[model samples]
Target: MAEFKGLSVSFAVKQKQDVQKQLFWPNLKNGPFNKLEDPVCCVKYCQSVPNFAVASGFQVEIRDPSANNAVVKNFHRFKSPVRSIAYRGLGSGLIAVGETNGHLSVHSVAMRTELRHMTAHTAAVTGLAFLAGVVGGGSTLSAAPKLASCAEDGRCLLWDVSDPQGQPLMEFDLSSASSSTSVSAPPADATAAAMDKATALDASQTDCNLLACGMINGRAYLLDSRQPRPALVLSHEHPVTCVRLAPGDNALYVAGDCWVRALSLHQGGRQIAAYRRHHKHVTDLAVGRGALLSCGLDGLVKVTDLLTYEEVQKYEYPNCGLLSMALSPGEADCLVLGTNDRWLLTRRYESPAAAAEAAEAAKSMSAAMKDPYLKAVKAYQVMPARPEDVVAPGPGRSRRPRQQLDQLDRLLKKFRHSDALSHVISKGQLKRKPQQAAAAMRELARRGALATALAGRPDVHVAALLKFVLHSLGNQDMAEDALPLASDLIEIYAAPRELRARPGIRPLFERLRALLAREIELGKQSAMCLGRVGLLLDTSAAAGGLAGSGGAAL
Candidate 1:
């Protein structure tokens, strides 16, 4: 039987049993840290990092919360007084401490390297995120992780830690001053409609590649790193206090004075949903499992299910307000609450669905890894004797195994060209350079018989035909004969959508354009040759026919 407590006891059985257990400071018996200060701002895990640190200006004493009687491992200066402490996910891994002075230091538990320090925000590093994979088919555990920091300065920096030097991979600046643009002289009433049209056009073409940033004046802008500047700017009724990227879709979730809004990743950050239940300013918002947790000066921790944006649970904390709140590494039914008093409280609750889902997930992972491709991929990962050995791994000038060749052929036939190309390239069966591939394609096209064989119904396209010819050409190089046909491809750009774009055509257009620009000098040389009396000039040939060229001419 599962036990329930508080007001939640009446519906205890309906909730799932959460597996994550709460262990107090360092898992010690009567630990070192206790009373929190004015407002607790942050909490995070330390086990994933080597030498994790936490700091807050509070009286230090540790108390054990676990029944296992675990011995505590005290951190160096664990009881030190500081302004605030912010923890990234996976506490055992890495931790960032913010001092009253505007500075942040990243400490790693495993490496003996010195603390990597950067003075970024003047006030404090308000929010910190370690960029672990939530999208691109990666889970928290499986994805490669990087460090991301958000500051009171309205700046976010993504640090590439894979490179020991900690290179800056991307950056987002939140402070964008509004610009004043004079209305250009236009037809009186049409000016408004024209501006709207221009706005829509720009929005449609915009790409949101960078994380969204909130401005001081309450506007949020979505930026693409490849573009010159921000792609979209969204206005808010009040200054945005907090923002986060959704785990699944990378959609922007922002909390402002009294509203928590979800903006679409597509359509240039258009508002998709907004919640208006919070009567006061929203301080921070955290997402976990299927629910969103928000804290405000209202002393409320509002839990809303993501699916419906409806309030699922509300708990009042014993403080003026919570500065920050975070979910456990396990995303458990419990939350690590940071209140204005500067103490971190671990509160547990009953949510049966969350527990059952975790069990199901555990069972699924316990099974053998599915996906046959990964196994084949692993077998192919061994380093060959030489780079060239990839193609002919075992012997001299070897051919690909019949089965593999058939697989490649079938993939190409099914229009899975990228995969087929990837497999061949991975195996080193084909050369990687674009030029080599182009030459091979041309040689294949010269073979008349191969073209007839591939011109099948409903599937025949210029691209497929060109690739077929290129494959048939094999090692032979025939650039001269291929160049003419390739040049004729300029007209094919507007070809039907069903027709694949052939490499043969584009190269031809490029070559022809170059020749036309230099035709005058070449034509002068041709005229000089005709005047030497060594060559007979035919009037009919000049008229674009061979008929006059063969006749007896003076």
Candidate 2:
């Protein structure tokens, strides 16, 4: 194998163009590699988030990302591709790399030249992570940072990387047993029991210790270091692509099914936020204050606000897929992005002026709520706009309750499916069973209640329309003509493509491609019809006005 940029760049050679055209070949100003022999699979920084201490490939090279395109120092060499690399924390100076040969090697970046090496699995190692510094009795404790590894052999083993050739701290073989109905579960067939036994064996390592393991089945298990068994197991519809523990926040972020879910241990396993915003498998995630950056095989990089879970920025590459991301340790605004093509990119935070502009946009939106219908109505404010205050009476007087609309708004805001349904029922919008509330709403919109109630107060307009459609369709007297229109509307509203491609709904993209095509066609037709009618009215009014003026003169 030939070396370019100090790492192996495999010779698949699909492109004959000069190396200068490839971003990875153009040595970064701060990159360490000068020669690479194989295509890099994954790269990471050893110091902190984006501070590059060591860049790993088939053979590892140690250098800082801030150093000027300098030669990489020998950290360690392994037999297989460096699939996973991790560092404990700032200043500890320990670096760990897992390779495809089922070997894990640890080196001291700031200390000894060669520290320790161990073969921990029979298959390729896929995952590695460092537990944060330990704390006990409300105070800090100092000890060697422990290392964890997951492999294709279906085992996760813990190692003491502070010393070379050291024994594994603990070992867990998750696939020791398959599904069985035996009453007397023998030791060989007792995987769960063995897991519990392992938990008890490692009880001394507990405090502030949390081990997360991702299985080949797309399941994630949170195991308490002190307990022999997993504290929680979450299954994804698709194989779990990646799992990460957030620094500082002690939160667990897992990505699968094209979504990143933030789960808080502080809240007793409650899900804090679900960012359903990517169209393909989310392969990696890096968390920082106020925001999160996620990338996947689809070559899309998205930054999202931690508080609101709204995507703030999106970047795409032509053929490169992102493999990992790290935030710069020294600067809050700087980020380091690594991709499958062996290229690295840097991004800084939005300028203060840009932030101020964003704030101004938000303020303008808040100020636009001049209509009472669009403004939030509290339970107390929902009380009859005082019947006496009305210039003319409307039908809502009898059906409207002070808290009903307010409650609907609250439910929608919280994503409380049942609560929103209760409001729909209390307002006598859906005559069907309350359990079918969401479905009823969908049915109602299909039947034209959506168009009729578009003018309703912002809080309940959507709810009322949904209710109207459901009631109209469920009614026995409905006509066949109405059915076709309702069916068309339903298909339009429920278009899978529209739902998935729309921002923040990527997790539900099962139907996006189909829905998007129909929506575009329908939109064009609607625009054409509206334009034709407007032109017709304009001409008719002009002619009538001209004729009336002449008659008046006579």
Per-residue lDDT of candidate 2, residues 55-101 (tens digit): 44765655444554343555545677777776554443666777777
User: Each model's TM-score?
Assistant: 0.43, 0.50
Residue-wise C-alpha lDDT for candidate 1, range 1-554, written one tens digit per residue:
00112223334432431211122211211122235444554444432322222334532112222422122332234223334343333422344454444455555432323245655444445444454332112112233355555444444455543444544555543334423122122123444322211100001111223445554456666654443245667776567777766766546777877677877766577676776544356877776665678887655677765555656655644225666665543434345556676555556553456658888898898665566787789879975587764564456767766655466567555544334444444444443444544533343344322222121112224444344334333323543443433333322232432123233445433444565455546668888976764444454346655545556452
Candidate 1's displacement at residue 182, Å, is 30
Error of 2 at 337 (Å): 1.7
Model 2 ranges off by over 4 Å: 1-37, 47-50, 53-56, 68-72, 89-92, 134-143, 163-165, 173-208, 248-250, 349-554
Assess candidate 1 and give its lDDT: 0.46
Clashes counted in candidate 1 amount to 40
lDDT of each: 0.46, 0.53
lDDT over C-alpha atoms for residue 300 of model 2: 62
- Per TM-score, the best of the predicted structures is 2
The numbered model that scores best in lDDT is: 2
